[model samples]
Target: MLQRLKLLEHINPGAAHRNVADSIPPPQLHKMSLPYNKVLVLGATSGIGLAYAEKIVEDGKKAIVVGRRKENLDAFVEKHGKDKAEAITFDITQVGTIPNFVEDITKRHPDLDCVLLNSGIQRGFDFAQPETVDLDVLDLELTTNYIAHVHLTQAFLPHLQKQSKQTALVYTSSGLALVPSVKRLNYCASKAALHHFLLCLREQMKDGPGNVKVIEIFPPAVQTELHDEKHQPDIKNGRQMGMPLDEFTAESWAKLVQGDDQIAVGMADRLFALFENTRQQQFQKMVEMMKGH
Candidate 1:
């Protein structure tokens, strides 16, 4: 009788374990694939954009870097070798000229599969000191940072859609959009607008038939010369504040290749999670605080 009871208990437990295992589904396998061979890096003359370009070329892929500065573009191409990298000079702020610019580039490299919109400007402003914020500077900032990016996306959309394989459109926004910096009202607003724009585009793409992937990168302060030529005394040096350029770039590159839709490096990643949890309330409060209400 004792032996029978022990055998019964063991049999029941084994049956239960088998049932549980059967109920749980097996892990699905993802089909790994390479999407594209050629890429375009807009505003590749400096900062994160430049780093991304270097990374792509180092991976033994073709990179076409677009920027306004001929010297900077030339220097990058020379460093990377002409066989792997190409440079094109075009000012994104010139909206009327972008159609032609897009046509020329697409004609030259019909196989282009990725476009990274990284051109932007940051200006420090004092709402209390309105004299520091000139209308010309404000216009320049808006045109370069926001308006031109929209035009470039519009111009590139049709070409990207025509490709049979998956294409990627990447935008470099800022962490300031999540937590506003009082000194850079224009820059923050522009990035906030971009964040919304890309979100909407992602939604629209879902409803459409195109396989184009939209990605947004929010980079925390890195060592770059974005504010140096502009001569902003109050602007904190990014190098002194946090992560070095190479470290930030390495992490960012890894995220991009791993198919992360929204990439944030270092402190920015933590901040992004916080922003996601408290977005609506935090954004509203930021607006009110910036307005001095």
Candidate 2:
């Protein structure tokens, strides 16, 4: 215990006594309106992102789909109609360009009320055979999944906060975030980091101005192109794995419309419940103790 205390002090000398404010929003405050008519969806070229974009358009809402592939972007716009959907070619891994990109998009579409960050990549790693792990792939996975999302949030937050009506910053995390998959080391770790980041962001936003809601959707391994069968040969027929895209989308969309800030579907729901039941109370106690200090 003494060693642990010393380690904590060494990590951040001033952390224990820092005045941490309560970050919990009231239950009534959470049930705000879903007035997000125009949404900006990152990584909407395919998979879960494209499914969400299609759903948004189907609901008569405007969806601005962003992806790295121009061909895919053009195809989405062509299918959805330009009136209901707009497409932008963007690579989220280009962290340096994110601010300007956000600036341009916000200026062009000032009515954009919601931003959905769903871009991510997954790769398998075996630490036992360290030689098989590609460091480049590992870095890219982390960047695409977690780092880029943080940058995008920072860039768009100011604009979202300026809106008079309710606005949202939505994230598509995974059930693996709560209960990690051992083989997909970086993928699971990135999601875990993102989950914690969302928690901190919510607390900070609770104390800030404007109604910029932070919503998170936790998906169980849905039928998507996230897993690369070509590269990760062990995972065959990747797209056929996990929950069906339509089923997951239907359930998640329902929860989103019902104003659930944290939407966990299927297996993710159970994992979320188990994790939160044990950890949330302890987290609240820690927060209270810090504030008292």
Expressed as tens digits, the lDDT of each residue in 163-239 for candidate 2 is 88889999999988888888998999999999999987887788668888999999999998887597667899998
In angstroms, give how far residue 219 of model 1 lies from its true place: 0.2
* Tens-place lDDT digits, model 1, residues 1-293: 76765676787755533555687889997733335578899999988889988888877788899998999999998998889999999999889999999999999998899999999888887879777678888888888888999999999998888888889899998877677788888888998888878876875676456678999998887777766534566755643555677988888887888898888776668886776547746755765576543
TM-score of every model versus the real structure: 0.81, 0.86
- True-vs-predicted CA distance for residue 31, candidate 2, Å: 16
Pairs in steric clash, model 1: none
Candidate 1 — number of clashing residue pairs? 0
The deviation in Å at residue 254 for candidate 1 is 0.7
